[model samples]
Target: MNRKRLEQILDVSLTMFREKGFDDTSVMDICNACGITKPTFYKYVNSKEELLRHYYDGALETLIQAMDEHEPSNDYVALIWIGLSMTASRSIDLGPDLLSKYMILNFHEHTVTARYSAGGKQRTVEAIRKAQEAGQIRNLCDPEKLFMALKNLSLGLTLKWIMTKGSFPFFSHYGRMVEDIILPDYDTVLKQTGVDHRKKTG
Candidate 1:
């Protein structure tokens, strides 16, 4: 098949998978949608499962790319959260069924899981270290504990969105909440500590 046709097939397949899920969507569904025969579909992908995995992994690759592009700052946690929110927003548009499939099929077994678990922990820990160096975030909390808290918050938000049938605009609202939790206004923190902002950098 040509490059454009292959791209078209994958696009339609993702849409169908998002709508009907992996198990429910069949080769016939993809072929019918793409106006091709079963033989043609099979030429591109061996099975619907493979297609599902490909699309899911593609989304994850996008997330990792976004994370890599984020530049560290004094509020590293907040910056990471912003990048994560952008990733979340992109993933959500890929369809909830596809998202749910990702959770069900590869939540514990995929490359993305490794990145989410191992890579994310490292990134959070490193960001905390940076914050400690900058004397911005408090060092009282263990880096691992902070990482878990942030991850749990994001997962909880995502799960709630799924359960509610997408009732909330999660990425937008949740980003603000995460920001407040991770990086509250610097002036507010200073004022709370009895440091007169007006006398210093204020």
Candidate 2:
């Protein structure tokens, strides 16, 4: 019933769930591993799904906080580097399968799940908007559109990196590619837009 005991249970359950998945992990599996009885286990949680929700919820909150705290950088290239580094650090603590599986399982369950996913996308968009406003990104297209484009590139890079087990090293090259994308149209938009988006929040 205490916080420490609950945290221990959650940690144990997360490891087991990650290794064997939700369906394969049972209350008995958790209890036996933790030296607790079924009644004792039930005191903290009702089911495996609830535990998944807890982990998912905590991970998403951490991600949002990281995005919020990223230092404001002038250029899109710099921002991409900063963003990927933040992402790598956060993803390192959890399994690589965490985001993909959570997205697959909960993307359609409720408005809150949809909001969590959207919040990530929105953060990326806002970062780009801030960069554009700062005159650090090209302005040939809409800020939102540019954000989506950059997001797609990042997603592709992430998938490639995951498939190759870090062989591609997207983090090393992402900033340069982002720079290439924004540099061609920098002159027109850079001068026309002066909103200073780094000050905005999502």
Candidate 3:
């Protein structure tokens, strides 16, 4: 497979998805935009849905970087909420129509959106574990469970946001979910006030 050609395909595909909407954009449309044949498009991925999933491959890394920006702070709780808000805002910027395609496939096949979007996020689990270790979040529930909570929160909120025709307040609602699910079991952890690391540039 030609990595350069594949990158070109993905770039064009993402642009088409953004401009034309994922449902309306056919594989032939992508091939035409990329100046590739059906066979050539197939050489890189099985289907257009598969190619869209590839876009999500970077979303995990994006979330990790968002979380890491607030690290080394005693207030892991705030950091987690900040990450959720940031990712939620990013999704809104990505547009709801594009994500709706994955949500549709996710219901039946349980593919990329099921795994990468929802379950089996080890990095997210590790972040939760760190907060748990620091007594910033409830330690009774395992980090794995907390990760699932995050995924569930994100998925549900995103779906609703899409269904509402972009009217839903995803960032605010997501923050509430994080506070309800991952916030401390006690009050002491909440008292760790610090700088708004979200504003920190480093």
Candidate 4:
């Protein structure tokens, strides 16, 4: 399946859902919006709810691509921080409303949640090892264990944003949480990456 075509379907679906509400937005409504038939839609996703999973997974593509293109000798800690910054931006773009739906759906289908992100999660774990070797991350951090912690943190932050309706300075808060809890010395990482995440995140 053409991934661009799949993205198109997801984009149109989001727009329709925002305007029409998810419950009222039928598969045919999305199909009509994307100019794809039901069979074609099914080829892209098993169901509309699955689009939420695809959208969630799509947020990681930027990080994966960055990791793929990154030089091995560069600051691995900075690389991880920049990748996650982009991932956080992508999550915000997905909108809290959609994220809430995704959270609720995944809550009921907990087993399927991690299944959607297996490939991306593996790549992130690989990056974690690189970061650890660079001395950017504390050596005490176990790669897989750290990955689970960051994953849970991402979900928790998403819930926080939804509950607040984005009233807070999200990126700044996210930066503090990461630096203080998830990724130590992450401020230095952001500096090395040349990312003024404050500007980018807002």
Candidate 5:
């Protein structure tokens, strides 16, 4: 397989799916957009659904990488915020409709989506455990429960954003939730943990 060409096809297909919706975007549409013939497109992917699966995998891979790259800090809240921001930005990049379709397809499955979700949850649980050990999380709740709360909040906000057709500002909403509700005493936590809270700016 030509990796570069495959990427090009996926990119074009994602754009088409985002703009045109899944049902409306034909295989020929994707092929024409990629400047490839149907046969060539078939050589890479068997169907439009497969193309969508590839797109979902690509986005999930990005989030997994971001989660892995986050360095441990006493400001573990910031680390969580960074992961949330990355996820929100990726969903926004995919646009609402494509994201909705992706969610619907694998929302209840033990598939690629489930694998990514499990990996992300594991990373989050680890982060929470570290924070608890460092006394950043004063509540001393179960790490798994805390992780589930965070995950639910993130998923709920994303669902709302999609349902509203992108009228909602997910990134800003997530940041505010982190700053005001989730970690209102984040600065104090950092200080208590003897770690300076250095604000990360984009």
Candidate 6:
């Protein structure tokens, strides 16, 4: 497949979905927007829902890349906070309606959403293991359980933010939750970890 052309199709489809809503947007609409024929569009993606999955999968890949670049001294807890904050900020950019649709799709088990979600959890588990090995994280609890709890909490908060139409300061509120609730020693470990969580770039 032509990588550039595929990206163009996904970008155009995302815009159309945002403006017209997923239910209203058709394959022909995306084809027209991208100056491509329906057959050409079909060659890239099988259906509109597939295009939506591509959008989410791409977004999660971007987050994983960001984490890899900024990973700090095996500090899994801090990394979790950074990922959650970044996701909240990105969701706000995508707009509440579109983000809600993405979240709803994410609940289904057979899409790229499920794959990305599982992949993210696996990455977090690895990070948690490293942190435990390095004595940065206490090993008293199961790493997998801890990671799942953190992931679920972040998702719930994000869903609540979307449901509220972005009225809440999700990024800042999440940061506070990390500091005060989830990781009370977040700042101290971050200092030791030598990772700047605030310097994420696009």
Compare candidates 1 and 3 on TM-score and give the better one. Answer: 3
| TM-score head-to-head 1 vs 6, winner | 6
lDDT of 5 by residue, 1-202 (tens): 8999999998888777767788999999988888989999999998776676675455557767776676534466656666556655665677788877767776645343332366666766776677667656564678788667666677778788889988977787877665554443556665755555555422
The per-model lDDT (C-alpha) reads 0.62, 0.59, 0.69, 0.70, 0.69, 0.67
lDDT at residue 119 of model 5 (Cα atoms): 62
In candidate 4 the C-alpha lDDT for residue 183 amounts to: 54
What ranking of all candidate models by lDDT puts the best one first? 4, 3, 5, 6, 1, 2
Cα miss at 88, model 3 (Å)? 5.8
Looking at candidate 2, the ten consecutive residues that score lowest on lDDT are 193-202
In Å, residue 4's CA in model 2 sits off its true spot by 4.0
Q: Which prediction has the highest lDDT against the true structure?
A: 4
Error of 6 at 114 (Å): 4.0
Pairs of residues clashing in candidate 1 = none
lDDT of 6: 0.67
TM-score of each: 0.65, 0.55, 0.73, 0.71, 0.77, 0.74
Model 2 Cα shift for residue 25 (angstroms): 3.7
RMSD of candidate 5 to the truth, in angstroms, is 3.5
- Report the lDDT tens digits of candidate 2 across residue range 32-71: 9989889988898886556655554455466567665654
Clashing pairs in 3: none
Best by TM-score: 5
